[model samples]
Every structure is written in C-alpha cells, then in structure tokens.
Target chain A: MAVNDAGAKQVATYWEGMVNSGLADTKAYGTTDFYNGLGSGKYVTYLAAGWGPGYLASVAKTTSGKWRAAPLPQWTAGGNVQGDWGGSSFAVTDQAKNPEVATKVAMDIYGAKNTDAWKIGIDEAYLFPTATPVLESDAFLKKKYDFFGGQTVNDIFVPAYKTISPFSWSPFNSYNFNQLTTGINGAIEKKTSWTAALDTAQANISQYATQQGFKVQ
Target chain B: MTQVETRSATAPAVAGPAPRFKRGREAATGWLFVLPFVILLVAFLLLPMAYAFKLSLYRSTLIEGEHFALFENYTQAFKDPLVRQGVVRVVLFGLVQTPVMIGIALLAALLIDHATSRFSRFFRLAAFVPYAVPVVIGTLMWGFLYSQDTGPLSSILHVDFLSSNVVLASLGNVVTWQWAGYNMIVLYAALQGLPREVYESARIDGAGPSQIAWRIKTPMISSAIILATLFTILGTLQFFTEPLILQPLNPGSITQHYTPNVYAFNQAFSFQQYNYSAAISFLLGAVVFVGSYIFLFATRKRSAL
Candidate 1:
C-alpha cells in the first residue's frame, strides 16, 4: 500500500459518517442480527460486487420492490476508478474422471453459443453476463428486474463495470488485508491518527515482505 | 465387548489357578475395557501433538527450501511483540475474570445450597442454563447486547462495550458468562455432597451463616475449587472464540493476533505459516502448563498457611 494518510482518513471519515448517522451499525457479522438488520430497514445500503444484488434479493424480503440499482458513491468527485469484492469462476480440473465431458459441461454453462445456458445463468442464477453474446443479448440488456422495481439495472451496471481500473495484486494479499484493516480500524476507533496507523501498517507490511524475500522498493 | 468379556472369562479357566491368576485376569479385563479409549487418545491427542511439535521445528519459506530450523521459530515467537502482548493481556484477563467467575459461582452455589425458598431451584437452573448455550452463541448474544445502537444495555448504560478501551474486559465478560454456570454446577454438586452434620455443628458453635460458608463450607470444597481454577486457567490462556467472534464488530480492538490461539489460527490459515503457528500454539501450551503448575504448587499445602 502507498499509505496515503489523507486518503485513508477520508475513507475512514466516510464510514464513520454512516456509523455516526445511525444508518450503519457495526454489529457483529454472521449472526441473525446481521441478516435481520438490513432486511428490517436498519441498513439503507449494502455495498458489494456485481454479483451482490442477486444475494441481496435473496436476503432482503420486505424491501424487495423498493430497491434500485445505482452506481457506487464516489470517494472523490468523478472518481470512476473502481474495485470489486466478489466474482465467480469455474474450472474443470485434471482430477476429473471424465475430463472431456467435464470440460464441455463447464464451458457450455456460460458459453457464447448456449442461449438456454445463458438464460439460466443470467436470468435465473443472476450471474453477471461475462460472455459477449449474453452481454449483447436483447433480453439481458432490456430485462426489468422486479426486485429493483422493474428497472433495467443493466443500464447502470454495464457501464459501471467498464469503469474498473487495473488493480495490481500482492502475493501476500491476506497480510495486506489484515494490516489495512488494523490501520482503518484504529483510525475508526480514534485510538491513533490515520497517518500513524497507516505508517505502522506500511512499515509492518514492508518488513514482512522483506522477510518473505520480496524486494522492498 | 461381550466377546472380550467371554475371552477374559475363559482365559483364567483354561490357563491359571485361582489365587495369583485372579490378579492377571482382572488386569487383562481392565486393559480390555480401556483399549478403545487408549487407542483414541493416542490417535487424536498424542499423534497430532507430536506432528505439531515436528512442524514447529521446521520453517518452510518461499526463498529458503524447507529444512530443519530447530528452535528458530520458538526464538522468533519469544521475541514477537504480538505474542508477548497477547500473552500478557490474556494473563491479566485471567487474573480478573477467573476469580470473578469462581467467586460468583461459589456465591451462587452457596446461596442455592442453603436457600429456604423454592425459587432457589429456579435460580440454580437459570445459572446453569448459560452453560448449555454454546460459547459462540453466547458470545454472539453478548455482542448484540454490547452494540452501541441496537442494544438496550448500551443505550441505557451510555457505553460502547466493544470500544478499544474496554473490548478486552468485554471479551472476559462473555467467557465468564459462558463458563461461570459450569463452575457453579460443579461447586453446587460438591456443596450438596457435604455432610449436613458439619453445618449443624457449625450453627451450634454460634457461627453465623456467612461465617459458616466462608470458614467451613469453602474449606471443604477447596479441592473442587482448585480443580475448577485449573480448568478456568487453561481455558483463559487459550481464549479465542469470543474475541474471534466479536472481531468484525471492533476490528482494531480484536486484531488478528488478539489472543494466542487466534494468532495461531491466523498465522496458519490466513498467512499460511503453519510452522510458526505450531510454534506459537506449543508456546501457549507451555504457558498454560506452567501457569497451572504454579497455582497448584502455591496452593498444594491447602491451608498450611
């Protein structure tokens, strides 16, 4: 991480605003409280990836038709550079007993030519259209989701997806995540200044990377 | 089981005479009865521990190929601030929580033991009910109660229980709530088994109810209290579940390495450092062992003071 203290603080302030505003509750996750809170209108917004709305529809029963798809709120004015939190992938491993059949099934599941497969994958399973055919399909582009009050969410999402910038990943992704969380958490708790927390995280991650024999720039 | 019993019965009949052979036959039957348990003990406990010890002796690194690095991981763990800080924090937590829990348990047990009303039965059951609830579930419940907004306790008390300043104590509360009931049941059972005549004699000696409880009853159950203390100490040293469960709510307070067991878990699963994780786990085991040993040694005389 570059350890941009001001940027980190801005991010912290944004989250703190929600928590302070009583819109977001930092309640423990994986509990009934977590699930029921959002459904009960305790949480106004759920931030997640392209596949997130599908999951929201399953969990959000009362607010089904009240929802609308919108672009993520920008951290900075016109800040279109984006990141994602979730995606799905498929593979036919060498361990498969019938590798040829497995490959065919896996490829056909979202293959460009398989309209029926795309229908099930896109309309029913709520998968993001990855194939070009599915992306250009009239049904996909114009379809109105009842959950979002019959809005064509593809109008918002298809363009939003293209806004994502190239993100370089670290081999030590988990370490980076832990350290970043610690820094942000410390900033949120007001235990340390954002700069100090970020500096400490930067130092720690650098030292760890060095220990793992990565050249620290 | 019947086949083994039949075999044992037939053994003495075929081979040996009555007197000295009785001992051998009885020993064989005892071994037969314990064979399954011994096998499980070796397979689950001893073997896994042995493998972990082996793992602790080696570090597999990206640059350096896997090789014997005897005590290197141990040395690193000893100096690791996270490990030291976590140990000190937990030890302090145990110092506070263990006694508070045991004191509460003993008080509850004594009150129930000598209660005059029918409500005492209900109180005893109520106290024991938390023990029936799983620790994770109990922690989750407390997490809700501790939430700053939704929880009535927080709104009423005007405190954020999961705040960094107080989260450690908050975790202690969860563990105490979960285990106090179990300790209460143990102490209560011990209290029930005490001879009634001792209390009668104490009363005749002009001892007040409080005096009788503190002087006579407490001393009588010292062994069970010590046993419970040992268990609580061990549990406290390896504290993980509550902190782990509540981490997401207060991420900074309950950092990945907030406790030794949680640290080991993060190191092994998150960082993929199995060797270092194993080393830390064993070091924590040593700490727990030494902690209990010191307690037992200090109190071994059991009133010689």
Candidate 2:
C-alpha cells in the first residue's frame, strides 16, 4: 500500500532491523498512517518513513516518549544520499524600508554561524532554517542525544542540505496543488474512477491555467 | 372690499421674511457635521474603488520594465477558460449554497425565538460561536475535521468527507456552519422586533406556534430575511479562503480557477497576467453589482405584493 518508493525502502529496512533484533512482533505503518495512529497511541514508537528536516524535527519530539529519530535506513546498495521532506525560503520584499540591511540581517539570522541555534530553534519552534553554513555548524553537526537512540541527525541533515533541489514556488502553486489534491482525495473517498477524477482535475487545472493565461499542454 | 381689507390687515404676517443668513448658517453647520464622514468615505472607500477600476483597465505586472496594456487584460480574461469556470462555480455556489444557508439561518432563528425553554440565550450564543472564531481559523478547524486521517468526523463516520468529489459540499457545510449563527442573530433580531400585539392576537384565536410563525412571524420579518439573503448571496459570490485552505486536503477538488477571486489572484501573482487579472476582477465586480441589483429587484417585487 506504500506509494513512495523511497518510503517503502525505509519501511523495509526498519522491519528487517526489527525482525533481526527479535522485535518481529512489532508492526509498522506508513508515515501518513503512523501520524494518524499517533492520536490513538496504537504504535510503541514511530520512525519517520522519509527524509526531511521537518520530519526529523517531528520524530525528535515524540509525545509518547517511546518515539525517536534516526538516519533513514539506506535504500540503494551503499546509498548515502539523504533527502528533504519540506523546507521554505525567505525573500526581501521590494517594499522593505532598507532592502540591503534587511537582506543582511536575514542572512545573519539564517546563515551558517547560526546553524546550531537555528536547529535548536527549529527543534523547539518547528521552523526549518535553509542556510547551509548554519546547518553544517558544530552546534548542528555535533548534536547527540538519547533521541533517535543517540544518532546525530545533523550528520545526515547537514549533508543532505547540499543535495537538496532548489524549488520554485509560484503563487499559483498553492491554488493548483490544492485543486489537484482535493480532486484526488474526492476520487479516493467516493470510490470513483481514478481516470475520471484525473480528467476532471486536469480539465479544472487547465481551465485555471488558461484563465490565468498560462499555456497548457 | 371687506375681504380685501382683511387680507391687507394680515398681509405683513403672511409675508414672512426669509431667515436669510441664519438658515444659511444652519445649512453650513449640517455640512460641517457630515464633512469628516465624507472625507473618510472619499479617502478610503471611494478612492480605492476608483483606483481599482483604473488598475483593472491597465496591465501593471509588479515586475520591473513592464509596460501598461489597456483593456488587453480584460480581453485576455474573456478568453480564459479558468476564469469562465471560476465565474460559473461561484454563480452556482451562490445559487445552491446561499439559499440553503439562509434557509437554515431562518429556521434556527425562528426556533430560538419560539423556544419555550429558558436556555434560548445559551442556544443563541452556542450557535453564534462559529462566527466569533476568525474565518481562517474556523476553516482550518473544519479542514482538520474533514481530514480523512485526523478529523474526528471522518473517524466517526468512517468516511473521508473532505475527499474531492464531496469537498464542495464539505466546503458548503463549513460555510453554513460558520455563518448560520451570524445570520440567525440578524433574523432573530428582526423576529423580536415584530409587534407583540399580533402574536398575542394570534394566540388568543387558539393559533398554534407554527401557525403564528408561518402566517404572522415570517411575513413580519420578510424584510430581514431578504436582507440576509442578499448579504449571503454577495458573500458567497466572493468565496475564496474556504476553498483555498480546503484545497490542501483534496488537491483536485479546487483548482486555481475554482473561484473568480482566486482566478484573479493567480493571474496577477503567478502568471504575471496583471491585465487579465484586472479584467477578471472588474468582471467579478460587475457580476456582483448586477447580481445584487437583480436580487434587490426580485425581493422588492416579492415584498410589494
């Protein structure tokens, strides 16, 4: 039932590790199902099924006290690359009173030296800092704790930051994605044909694009 | 001759002199009293509308080096399918959701007004609590509640109410839930304003509560109902945030062009189709204006008879 390939690999690793460690009785679920199960306290502990700074933070702060964070178990043979789940960027508004000063201050706050602080803040605040230098700092890099069985999350996250793809966010992205997601979910719930849902969604999005004057294929 | 003499005797009294400078001063005082409001109206309301109209006619993408294209945006919007869908969706939404919402509000108002229990005040406040919550927060709360995984309703119903096919209905539910209380308060106020004597006379004639409500109460407060209907219609036409936030739960349920306002927003911000966005906005405004006029005319006709 797992939809994501990377996520399935992660789950397989966790299950295999559990079986080897004589924890075969334990059951595992996808990240989506796991979070849903959290409210009911059905699982002993939940390991995040995917890589992401945001997911890392959530896994680190388990209310059940049984949950912990760890480096995602590898997928490929000798696979070392990590991936991000979600992140956001900051921009200086054109209307800002002092764009240069504002940019400088923003850089300092989000930049490398502040990595540990940002990580700590993110741990506490759930706000991910995107600056690389700060992400690689000792404060972020050397962190070790009982959380995630004492694994250093920064070791994985800081390295993954470099490999992260730069994503462009359009204002239309929120609108377009929303419509698409809603349509998909509706199809799933109603037990309607997926093709029909997709066609409807495509038509809706295309119509939207055309209205917004975007050339659609 | 006698009549003429009498008229002459009263001529000075009949020829009352104009109050001249004092009346002019009183007129000046009246204008002075209204000047602050007039200034504020012009500065805030009138100016922005005029500016929006001007902006709507010209294309000014926030991007630098962009030149103005007059009426080109409007023409392009007319050609956009998304804009057309948004308009169609909103019109349909207004047609479907507004009446249902107002009807529920009216029923609730009547129920609370006629409730024989002492807890009517509590009922009124409980119903109105949704309005007190900010719309964004309220919608978000509903979003979570409609969520397949986390929402309590979904868990209880064992169904994903926020799924794509039914999400519009779900959005309608949230809108109805949030505003029903607000509209109820207005209708209830109108109901209370009805002359007590009419109800008393109805009761003396052995007329039941329903009879009184149907024959007397509703007719007396029809104006309030019409006003609420108009407000709901206008509000539904400008639907945005509910669908926008709800979009996250069901991706394809609402598209960028699901509503006219969202369409205009995406054009301006995403595609940089500023002229098209402007044109769409003016078109939406015009739709609302014409729709309101039609609604007002229909209600006036209904009330006239």
Query: What lDDT score is found at residue A203 in candidate 1?
Result: 92
Itemize residue pairs with steric clashes in candidate 1: none
| Poorest stretch of ten by lDDT in candidate 1 chain A | A24-33
Local distance difference test, candidate 1 = 0.83
lDDT of 2 by residue, A61-108 (tens): 554334455555566877765554444677899999999999998877
DockQ of 1: 0.45
Best by TM-score: 1
- For candidate 2, the docking band is incorrect
C-alpha lDDT score of every prediction, in listed order: 0.83, 0.69
Candidate 2 stretches greater than 4 Å from native: A1-55, A58-60, A63-142, A158-217, B1-24, B61-64, B115-117, B199-208, B268-275
DockQ (C-alpha based) per candidate is 0.45, 0.16
Q: RMSD per prediction, one decimal?
A: 3.5, 9.4
Best by DockQ: 1
TM-score of chain A of 2: 0.61
Q: What stretches of model 1 exceed 4 Å from their correct place? A: A1-48, A64-67, A72-80, A94-98, A165-168, B1-7, B10-29, B63-65, B303-305
lDDT of 1 at B162: 82
Mark the 10 consecutive residues where model 1 chain B has the least summed lDDT: B12-21
